[model samples]
Target: MIDKKTYNEIGVHIPSILLPKEGIDMQKWSVVACDQYTSEPEYWEEVEKKVGDNPSTLHLIFPEIYLEHGNADERIKRINNEMKRYINEGILVSQKPCMLLVDRSTPHTKSRKGLILAVDLEKYDYSAGSQTLIRATEGTVIERLPPRVKIRENAILELPHVMLLIDDPDKTVIEPLAGKLDSFEKVYDFELMMNGGHIRGYRIDDGETLKGILKAIEALADPEVFKSKYKVGDDKGVLLFAVGDGNHSLASAKVHWENVKKSLSEAEVEDHPARFALVEVVNVHDDGIVFEPIHRVLFNIEPESVLNALQDFFGSSCCSLEKFDSLESVNKRLSELKREEAVHSFGFVTDRSFGVFTVQNLKHNLEVATLQGFLDYYLGKQKEAKVDYIHGEDVVTKLGSKPGNIGFYLPSMEKHDLFKTVILDGVLPRKTFSMGEAEEKRFYLECRKIVKD
Candidate 1:
């Protein structure tokens, strides 16, 4: 169990984790993060069919794709009630205080490792230019929090999909834990549904192991060590943790904590369950973690008008387009272009044509940034047009081929540049990049109580 001193020192706590009882179907009990599959309602429909009348995380969390479909109030009520039911019926049994070490194996990527623990929200800040030890890697959209807040405010438990990144280049913290897995107890080992992946978790409750983990985290956070690693000046603020995924959820937790803390006394606030949010901290340099670019797909817009706007926005000198005969051609050219040059470029697939667009004398460090700037302005004028941040290039090709839709394929950003970029330039634009494909995202496996009993 983690003590108050460790919590204060590392801003992490060993949680009273809740897991499915031994008899329950583990595959049905777990689900992907709710925020995923926003553009694909059919995916959620399959999940609903699979989890029919069974106790599942799907019942506890609201999928964002359905956010605008109405009946949200009723859904929230049911979600909260289900949480109470799950706890009261012993479907979710409480475990001893410990951190969970997760090994996630997906078909497309290497096995990813993560450590799950409750992060103290008191030490986190997601607003612009936050210098807190835990910082957000992308800008938080304040407007996106209301729906999430509505779901979380009355919810009894939290099952996190939030992934935290520590810039541990030498693999000191989580790597060492892998060697000591035999000393800990195995918790859950099963295959995820809908071809998501296989996941296995082990409990880390040993006192000596816990202390060593905390010590390593402290070393990473040491100011001298941080400065030397980043080669930054002495006056620069230290950033120990970066929110790699689920920044909005973490921000929402912070918001809810801020609102609820007003009613608590100093003593009551010290170890409040709501004050800590559960997240998996993974090293940014982990071999298994792959950073993939989030491409854009615009709907309800004419392809010709989009092309015209792009040409006008960037002008003849800076912007140019080269046509390709097919999606395969576009993909082949993009693959080659990625290797040949450092120029800002994006591959596009529309109903009218397949092509690559290049922007010389780029304004931002990333091609996504330059494209996003234009799209923001273009969409403002073309009010009927809507944009969705997509994951894979193949998805973009398929979706953008539909009439009145266009997709922009962006190249992946270097994972190594994440922390340094966020520290130097504040947060990157929203929907900048994804840690992996949709299926590789963290599943909602473990739950923790947010309301004190």
Candidate 2:
């Protein structure tokens, strides 16, 4: 048996990872994360056409776009049924007690290295001002979590798209393994559908390497080392793992684990599969880890009403708005802003026009937080308005320019700022950053049985 103490100390576990058996078409079986391309139904439609009637991850996961179409209970029911069918029919087979070393090459970058891991939820906390081993980099939208929590509560096998990030400046953990990949067993290699990317998986099942990886990760969490690295006081919590890609997904897993623990004995809880969430852990220093701004588009609200509300909510005296003839002008203006000039600047688009809003004397470390503060306050006052975090400038612009809609194009934070920022600041405003564009997001390829026998 593997030492649970070693795993617990490092907040990591070796999963009996699952994949489709031989003779199955791996291409159709893999799908991009459900959260991507929310406004583009045509993207999912194309995916459906490619995966028709096959035993695919598409069958097990419910895409968010389908949630608004109504009969969500029916969709959830169908999803549960498909999971059981796949498991019982032997579609997903496991290579016992292993971690997957992944080499993913997307169109945007050459290669991103990741290790598939099962992280202990007990060490994770998403609440504001967390000091746990695992922390959230951005604020989580609690209202956006219920539907996801419901899906996970009944999920049999979890196909992970969530990614955890480590700030290893010395390249201690993942970088050293890249040169030695040939010694490992190659498991899966294929191109992702819909121009997503190409991925190759290799198995890491030996006890020697697993022990070394655990030790390296544990060293990163050393309180003294962490304090010196970030120049933080000893009173702060150690933040070894930060949710990089799927913030809410890990939050949902933590929620479901909390709920599950209530019904179990303390001993039973220790060994349950649901206590750990499957994730891909990548080094923040990875060459392919591009930090992109997650844009926002609010629907069913008058664009003028939103601007008026923003002006009123932040107080008319503190901020100023400048109008532009087109989005190009707004972009050019925002790019021209000096570091000292902009407390923060947001470029916006509406059905009528495009402009940039500059706010000074900020209340938060990030502009997203300042904007989200106003949005939450504004949405509470009106029942008809709703917001969605969008990927890509074109999608946000197109959606924002539609009638009765508005989109705010936020700026991307520096990639190097992530670990230190989250260290000193509790968490940034929700929907603060995205790992890459929608097409470059992690695709679902491997599965681990989340249900205990």
Candidate 3:
């Protein structure tokens, strides 16, 4: 990550970080990304009981499960107030301007390396077909932006769970920090609540170390290097950072920044606090990084209606549905699928039926795209029906098995194809891939002052 002057080139910089004061129980302080466990109220219920009035991040973020409960404006007010209160009460303290090296080991993954920094919103565009330095790996859902923007409107602080991905196959940017852990100050080391696993952070304030990281990031961002890596010409912009997790959150931040900068003069915009958003940068090749498929669950729609909609969306000939008695068999068949590129298979589940839906001569490269195209068209026509991107196979299965709900279990993406695929093809369909399952996600720990006093 670069400092303010060069943040434009890499779209990343050392940020003025915020952390809980010493003696605060990190176990109760840090929680998983707000977006996770949306379909399960029980999960959040347990978390609330554990974090009960403990001055935790639970107070700072509005979990998605409670999004529809009511009083959204009131919730936003409470969030902004908590941010200011934390600052006033010294519950949150500024860590000065610096970067952090993170070593997180989840129950599922070990020693997953990451760098905590801020990304220039000006250098990021979440729209599809974006050629910016930091582009979203998946399509941005436009409707998801307004609510998120509302959360940031009056909020003074941001606790970022957006994990950005870099195609650093040479292990240059973040991996090198593991060897020099002794050179940095250990900031926080604790177990995350709710089986999120253990994590430790080291502050990177060394000039020489930061300089080396900047050089490595610069080399990766070189236009020639991007072209050579993707086998493309110089016509395209170099895509160094891809939004792997928290796509909508990052998109909302970009939207918020765009709105704020419009009222400011050019001079004011240059060093504006809201101009950059905090994020964790992780190498795509890191051993801890794995692309889990994001499953889809349709609510308030019958399985038969869903099938008919799909049939109408993609002409009957190219689309076919074959029924199965059990999910196990459907999954087995979908797993054995190694067919032509154009042929795609998906595992489908409903209260009454389990099936495999196949699409021939696919309109999109991935199964998620083909299905998302249909879902977008279908949902536009059917207001009562809505889709939610799900993580963890069990949750999706349970939700999909509920009455009046349909779940489409998806296949995972190959990590090797991510960078080149994004470079050649504009972006994957929204909710295409997740870094890990629900519990493995990055918890809200580091905070940054997004607005000046």
Candidate 4:
């Protein structure tokens, strides 16, 4: 409900929990975004133990682990209460109108630096083939929007762990603002607890630097140049921003705003804060950003069952090899398989040992694009094919080695071809390339109120 003029003029005056320059004990002060590690409860448990009673960000935010619990409603109530408490108690302070400069370092030795500012929702759109100012790099999942809507509905404040990506590999937008850092005041600088690494922030009050960023964004948004950059036709609109992560969160905002718009007029509709979602936009070409492959683990299915499934999916040409006893052997075999050969491999595991299965001539809709869709179609018919998307090969091996489980490893998406592929062809399949691994994920820190006055 926030308009561009007001959004740019006053911006959203949301409060944030500021860390002192003396340096925060980051291990306790910084926590992973609530949505990460949803399938891994142990990680969250460790975080809880590490952040115990430390006035941590953990207390201020709700972990998605509690999403299914009975106390979820109560926890959300507490979150809203805490937002008011943090503001009323002066635990969070307000800054003069400006963009917040942030430097984030992950546990994986990668660092991302950017500015936190409110983007006008009016300029954003998420429809397919949308030339809207904002777009999704991968297809947005419509099914995941409801729970997020419920989470943000009554909240007094919204905290973002979402990172948006722009193709500014030349360090054009964010780097120039660093020179003016001395002109702005320092807001937060601390170490994130539990190996999240370090984070620092400065508030930019100078109109000149902010205007420069606006100009850069304007250039990227320019219709002709934008189309040429993507090599699309002149009639096509420019798709400048992409939802690198937190697609659901942004979709939830869109859903909530559409629902709220029924009773309000055009003018009144622009006043609500729910219109804009908070996100950190990083350059896709930023050296710190890496695209990792998301591997799959099928749980509670026996090794023989996996073999049988593969054989059934690929027909009589499928073959099983029990000699692939080591992880390296399986990797070497899988890497050598050609995409055009219609052959695929899987690592099967049981409580006692691990083995491998190689399938050939699997009937797939589009060999490269619909791997998950085909799996979903086949798995939907079977009772034991429970799949989990995982981040690292180590996790894949560990999970697949568990009782009644198997793992399928996929190749990583080529980063250079992502935008072109999406522009030429439609969006890629969901659960595609991960921006970074689990710990390197965007953390919840900056916030913007979607409701406007």
Candidate 5:
């Protein structure tokens, strides 16, 4: 198969946990990643009631909503206890080591296929100057790591909702595995609760298929080829294995491992399950994948304050476009303005008015780029201007239209440019692209116990 020996040499194992036949309601069992839609508690609450009393992943995990109010310590204790209980109860059946073929489909979309595998953590580096084989596509918010570390420190299992992307535009790696999915044994097939839709998985044990995947990954890792593909002067000593989603979760694993490494031996470190976190790898050019726009929300900022700030930032050149009653209307105007390349239209839904801010650029870069720089500086001075990245424009309008709220609807990043920008420039603006809308995210169904102590 793969250089399994190389992985072993690096002290990592690809242990897998599969769903039982009788308990195969994966849709309910597999919830979206804990970190997604953190602002929406009702969504999590609905999942709890639907998953109640069943052998669901919800039972074994703590929703991030409850993490606030000084309850995190208690949550971690309960999570650890439940993990131990699940393993002791023999509820989790271990599967033979192999790659997993995943296909997820929602009501409005077709199947989204992916391959699940473990990457060597030692090959990854998240630091700004890191030239590690595995790299982050955006700036990592360092402050988000501590709370995640607290959860992972005693986590008995690790389930991945994070997917990594490879720059292979051709059908080189994942496409071949998709063809063999039907030949392999089906591991899970069911509907996901909360309109998340149907999800099915297959195990890939064929030696030839596994070898192909390995060869493709190895080719991507070749320093000469990678540099030539990106047209960089030097290799930068890094491979563009991007964290498409779940950047914080990977960061969490990194943080905990560093802290625990001080007390472990070389052998112990190699054998630690934490050394290999499960992740799905997809080709960047997959027809099913799309980079959706993530918007910004500033809460507790008055509508008048927003107008004042806009007036101050752009002076008399700023003109307020007609108020949009619906997101569709706002989007139409934004599209119309984007064609001009000389003006920028911002959709803003405030208490005083639902309107667009048409600003003729007096200075700076792209309109969004210029606006972000000023927002960063403004929020730096005023701590109450809390910023959030929203997945849809509708969400932007819905959340921003609330009292004491303001929102900035940004355009989507062109998917084709993502790889080139990262390879040539080293990094892109943070939160530049989202794999898909919120529901398209990886679900948390499988789990690997990282710390058995």
Candidate 6:
């Protein structure tokens, strides 16, 4: 067990990770994050066929795609039952208290490395302008939490796809651990399903090694170090960790913890399982990590009217629209803008035509911020209009080309600016950037009990 002193020092707890017993098909057992493939039900259907009664994380998670399909209450009931059965039937066995060193490889990215550990929720604050050591990189949508809270509130086990980022530009924290992995025991090594690339985990159980990791993380959180790195004033709060992905999931955990803590005694609050959430923390400077933009696709809207509304809102002086004959020309223009160092320009594709919209004067720093603001207002006025945040240019072309559909492709934000921007300007707009494509997301492999026996 992790003592209070150690937990306080590192803002992490070594969890008793639950893994499937031997002879289980690890390939079928792991699945991508629940939040991914929300627009495509067929992806989940394919996953169902592959798992086929085998013990899998698919049974434990309620995919968002199915959230609106009805029977949500029944689905959550089945999830909780599966968790209990997994424990009772010895399908999942707990290991010694340790951190899991993860190595992930995908087709589009280099081998990304991370350490899976439980972070103290107390150190994290998702509210705007929070001064905590852990902060959200993007704004948290409270309305999106009820469905997630329902799934997590009564669950016996928690499997996290939440990825946290630490800005250790000098590579002090997670990088050094990779060198000493020879001493750690191997956990699970297998290829993930759904074209999600390979993954391997090692257990770090040595007390001294765990302490070393904590010390490194603490150094990154040091006030002077943070100030020097970001060139900020002494009054600025040190942001040691940032939410890289799954901001909503982490927020839900926080909300549930708040509700749970209210009913617990002071003693229970000290080491309550609900007080910490399991996450894989990765270094921001890791070469394997790539920041991709989450583009916007609008459905059931008059494309011409939407374009005119954008011009009306921003005015002709600030907003200019240039039409293109095909997707190639639009992409070519966007590629040129990248070399020209132009910002606040977005490419749009529709059934009628393709074009690029350039805004000379902007209220927000990122193009997505400016575009999303207008969309929120426009969609509010048009009750029939709907928008989905999507990844991949190909998806935008395919879906946005359908009649009455339009997609706006926004450029990605620089990885280096993420920490400093959040520290100075508060949280960014939601759905700002994706860490990688959907397939590259963290798959559920490890589990921990959140409810006390």
Q: Which residue pairs clash within candidate 5?
A: 11-270, 27-191, 27-192, 156-449, 157-448, 158-448
Question: In terms of lDDT, which candidate is stronger, 4 or 5?
Answer: 5
* Residue-level lDDT tens digits of model 6 in 1-453: 335585685577778889999988999999999988877789999999999999999999998899888899999999999999999999999998889899999988769999999998998899998988778999898889999988899998899999999998889878888888788888889989998999989999888888788878878887888888889997788898899998999999999899899999999998899898999999989999999999989999989999999999888887789999898898888887766444578999999889999887668988889998899889889999988888888889888888999999988999999998998999999999999988999999899999887
- TM-score, every prediction: 0.97, 0.96, 0.96, 0.86, 0.91, 0.97
- Model 3 C-alpha lDDT per residue in residues 112-150, reported as the tens digit of each score: 999999988989888778899999888887987898899
Q: Which residues of candidate 2, in runs, are more than 4 Å off?
A: 1-3
Off by over 4 Å in 1: 1-3, 335-342
Tens digit of lDDT per residue, candidate 5, span 34-148? 7667667788878888877777777666666676758778878877887777678777777877788888787646867788887767877777766777778776879878888
Q: How does candidate 5 score on lDDT?
A: 0.73
lDDT of 1 by residue, 1-453 (tens): 546685586687778999998888889889999988888889999999999989899999999898998999999999999999999999999999889999999988658999998899989999898889999988788989988988899999999999999999989999998988888899999999988889999999888888888888988888898888888877677898899999999999999999889999999999889999999999999888999999999999999789889988999887788988787787787777677454677889888789998887767887888899999899889888999988888889889989999999888899999999988889898889999999898888899999999
Candidate 4 residue 182 Cα shift, in angstroms, is: 3.8
Score candidate 4 by TM-score against the native. Answer: 0.86
By TM-score, how accurate is candidate 1? 0.97
- Model 3 Cα shift for residue 361 (angstroms): 2.4
